[model samples]
Target: LVGSATVLCTDKTGTLTENRMALAQVWLPSGEALTLKHGQPVSKDCRKLIETAALASDPHPSDPMEVALHNARGTFAGSESSSTLPIHTYGLRPDLPAMSNIWDDDQALTICAKGAPEAIISLCRLSDDAAQKVLKAVEDMATRGIRVLAVATSTAPDRQWADSQLDYHYTLAGLVGLADPIRASVPDAITECRRAGIRVVMITGDYATTARSIASQAGIEEGEVLTGSDLEALDD
Candidate 1:
């Protein structure tokens, strides 16, 4: 297959990137955003955002994003514990694309959710203006090659869990942007492929701007980016 192939299609995360995710930026609904530097103290709001995201994620996480959340929580919020386990969990679904966890906190149920920005925004039921502001923030982060996730929190009724995550009323906490640095060898490898007369194509679920930025870093030629919506509008 390698000898016969004239084109190579690759996923961006884990393939081109080191897969070691790092918390880089935070955007809040108050229109406050901050870019973080290593070994620097994060703002209180950013620390709260990371803590909430960590609560929403699995305690023993294997996914890169969840791992990053845990790491960030430790770095920003210190080694504090949740103390109580989650009473209920709403798993990520194709239709909603977000997940929520309900925890028993001092006889009250606290819900935390994190996932795709669109899903969380919908869950928060933000006004048109607020939603637009969030979308703009998402775009700005994506343009910088940051993978963004929306974070939210809610209060749940005792012993009455919803069948779906959508039933709860959530407040948008903030957005977290994770950075996955490209692998060191990718650019030279891509150049070698070009010299060998092969075309390199990046396939990712990331935003078009993010894909374009990573492609440029990896030495892939600038070309048309077809998103899911764009593909749906095309004829097969």
Candidate 2:
């Protein structure tokens, strides 16, 4: 943390949530990993949702959808070499042995994932209690038509060696929904900037429709908005 304090702003893509997301949190307490090719679960609720996130998603294992987000977040943070990538210094592959780009202990829950809220929620296999919680989260986010990503991760130890890459089964972490998700570290830095007395603002390249939708989710009041051209004219 820094010694300054001021308003902080950030994006909501991966910065607030895990890069690799899951729809459901079916914990194999038996110490077994649950693997699904798609969201093909016997349970109606679980199967339906998981299928959607996997199928509807535009991200491949490693590609632009992920990189474009990282690139944009880098610019926001003013990170060096971010013209290529911001907070992430090296090449990142979500499935490989890597820690998340976003690692903030404080306000972990507030971290959000944005893509398709409906698609993200479908991947979860919920118990009665867990289902209610997920549903509440989904409803709260959806009513605003905010794009949400159900953030979930399965953890294994660093040294745990396995014969197959598929040895580990994912554990359900939590659901992080972002109207317009940023890189995972964006929230952390934004929070830090606020604590350290810096100004945080959002300027986007998207059309007004999507840009405003996501901005609202990032906590801007729904009213006047400005575009890139607007800035150019002001300079005149």
Could you estimate the TM-score for every candidate?
A: 0.94, 0.27
Model 1 lDDT per residue over 1-236, tens place: 78888999999999999999989899988888988876788778778888999999987789999988888888876755456678889999989989998887677788999999999999999999999999999999998889999999998776578888889999999999999999999999999999999999999998788788889988899999999989899987
Q: Evaluate model 2: give its lDDT.
A: 0.37
Residue 173's lDDT within candidate 1 is 94
Q: List candidate 2 stretches off by more than 4 Å.
A: 1-5, 16-61, 64-200
Error of 1 at 94 (Å): 0.6
Residue 191 miss distance in model 1 (angstroms): 1.1
Query: What lDDT does each candidate get?
Result: 0.89, 0.37
Q: What lDDT is reached at residue 224 by model 1?
A: 97
Candidate 1 local lDDT, residue 118: 93
